[model samples]
Target: MKAFTDLEVWQRSRVLRNDISQLTKSFPSEEKYRLSDQIIRSSRSVGNNIAEGHGRFHYIDSSRFLITARGSLIETLDHLIVALDEKYITEEIFNKFKGDYETCLRMLNGYITYLRNQQPQKNG
Candidate 1:
């Protein structure tokens, strides 16, 4: 890709990050530095890591950052489940965000696979 922002996964993650920011605003004040902060940070990390990965010169280095990005995505999902259990969001809202998570995940995995293919073949 021309830039990290150009990656489909990064673009999709930006949408989710924005949505999570807005969603957390409705959370209880008590959660301002708790679950809300965690979810927001994790969501933001997804894009941050993806951008860092895209800037790497080596495919292996990029893959490592992408893996961390994927982990942050999963962490965001856990925060969503916590929100649901605490009645901070409706089941409908949870499902919507979950779908968005899956889309980013699929795209990220595909990108990782593409990068793997681009690696030089080993003589082993």
Candidate 2:
């Protein structure tokens, strides 16, 4: 990969971030600084971490950031759950976003595994 944007996981995350941002815009102003902000931040974090990870160059270093990105993906999903509970979104919307989250999760996991396999074996 020449750039972080080239990663499929990063691309999926970007889509999720945009979707979350658009969804939050319909939320009541009362949640402007609360759940709305939380979801947006978490969604954005996924892509941010992926990019940062790719920039690290080393397998272990990149893996650390990828792990963080995975956490952010889970966090974003939790936020979506909260949105569903609060009726800010319908079941259909929630499911769609959930699918998007899962795709990113899978892609991220696959990338991490690929990185690990590509790492050089160390001899004592």
Candidate 3:
């Protein structure tokens, strides 16, 4: 298999990071180091963990990291929701970001399932 960098999930996550960064630009200045930073860091973590996990030698190890990445993705969505409710994002922007997050979630879940299915059978 190719490296994690070559994986679609990683690539998509990279795109998500850029999208989130752009979206956060309109956030209130007071959130410069608060909500904005948290969202950006959490979004990047999703991709970073996926890449790091791919470099690991064991399937279980990789799966664990991907799971962590998934958690980060959810956290990002929560932050997005807050931003929307606070009027930091319009309905259109919220829809756009929500779509991307849902897509990423699907991709992550698929990757996890793929990894689980690839594990070698263990002796009883």
Best by lDDT: 1
lDDT of 2 by residue, 1-124 (tens): 5888887789889999998999999999999999999999999999999999999968999999999999999999999999999999999999999999888899999999998998899899
| Arranged by lDDT, best first | 1, 3, 2
Q: Distance from true position, residue 50, model 1, in Å? A: 0.4
lDDT of each: 0.96, 0.93, 0.94
lDDT of 3 at 115: 94
Model 1: per-residue Cα lDDT over 1-124, one tens digit each: 4988888899999999999999999999999999999999999999999999999999999999999999999999999999999999999999999999999999889988999999999896
lDDT of 3: 0.94
Pairs clashing within candidate 2: none
Cα lDDT tens digits, model 3, 23-104, are 8998999999999999999999999999989989998999999999999999999999999999999889889888999999
- Tell me the deviation in Å of residue 55 in model 1: 0.6
User: Which sections of candidate 2 miss by over 4 Å?
Assistant: none
Best candidate (score: TM-score): 1
